[model samples]
Target: MIQRIQSVFLALGAITSFGLFGTDAAETEVPVAGSEVFADAQYDVYDSLILTGGVLAAGLLLLIAIFLFTNRKLQVVLCNVALMITLAYAVYGGVLWYTDSAAAQAQVDFGALLPVLTMLFAALAARYVRKDEKLVRSADRLR
Candidate 1:
């Protein structure tokens, strides 16, 4: 059960990393000089990557929460890591939001929300795992 949980976590981590770091030729475009509308094409790409990563992380964390009882220890530790990562991502998104225009804030908000949700789910999963662990230990003592 622990091995399976680790595999799933590793798979999620791989997919999220690829989505965050992979460059898509289809998504890139050349910007014309003095074109105010498309001045920050690269930044847009970066934002898209961040948003994708956040969504993937959130989805994975929710899945982990749903399966928290399968491997309590591993899931709890993974949840802790996910919580920290999401918090960091949220901080980065906040900084971006403050530095950019309203349109960029929209993008930042989209990215920020996912990490926040991910953290929430991870925290919940950790709580469930810890509770279950305690219950199991108490049951063993009574045996």
Candidate 2:
């Protein structure tokens, strides 16, 4: 189920990066409302989307490793750390927006959600592992 969710997210990210979401590119001269109309370039969008996909893929790979190894504590710690960083990224973007900077506007996109999703799944994997461990420990104590 989790794998399926991750796959779906991956596909979504791919579709978004490929301009399925919008037809604006970073390098293209796009027309805005009340402004000159032109096709927009997607360089920045694609770059950010690619980066996000790469990071999410990395986290998924890590989750797979944890699943195979059942390393409860390690997975939990990793998930927590990833969540923190994800939060940081989110906050940073928010701050940039609050400052009313064009750069901040540039950073807004679906790619920003990748770390957050990865963190969530990693944490879920960790919880499963810890629950399995607790069951094992309980059995051992009964013995």
Candidate 3:
């Protein structure tokens, strides 16, 4: 089952989520009161309780879905859930950028796109899962 195409995609999705956990989510640059130089403040997702929980849950869900080879329907549902979690993470990141920009300098780093990649992988995995389910059904009708 681990050799399945969907499993590979799920693995990739999990890996990307782990990257989200390790990398810098965003950065802000603000000048000191009397200095011409600006200092960068980096935000890591793991530092926030909510973000950390959401990201870890997405990755774990992928892993759980991978083992549900016997239940294609459940696997598809879990993958979709994981996809939503990643999408929510990206939306929250945008909200932070929008809200933070008004008060001070805020720059969204490229790492913010990691959740997008995770979503793509999850979507691909779910597609393959659905294909497999359909194939199984068609074959059952023949026998």
Question: Scored by CA lDDT, what does every candidate get?
Answer: 0.50, 0.43, 0.79
Q: What TM-score, computed on C-alpha atoms, does each candidate reach? A: 0.55, 0.49, 0.84
**lDDT of residue 134 for candidate 2:** 80
Winner of 2 and 3 under TM-score: 3
Q: Write the per-residue lDDT of candidate 3 for residues 1-143, one digit (tens) a residue.
A: 77899999999998988888667766656432422111236666753566787799999999889899999999999999999988887677556545553324545666777888899999999999999999999999999
C-alpha positional error of residue 56 in candidate 2 after TM-score superposition, expressed in Å: 8.2
For all candidates, the clash counts are 0, 6, 0
lDDT of 2 at 90: 44
In model 2, which residue pairs have backbone atoms overlapping below 3 Å? 25-40, 25-41, 25-42, 26-41, 26-42, 28-41
Lowest summed lDDT across 10 adjacent residues in model 3 is found at 31-40
Winning model by TM-score:
3
CA-only RMSD, every prediction: 7.1, 7.3, 4.1
List of clashing residue pairs for candidate 3: none
lDDT of 1 at 28: 16
Taking the tens digit of each residue's C-alpha lDDT, what string does model 1 give over 1-143? 43443344444443443343343211115543443323453333255456457545645654554455466787678677767766766566556545543333222213223344445555655665677688889999999
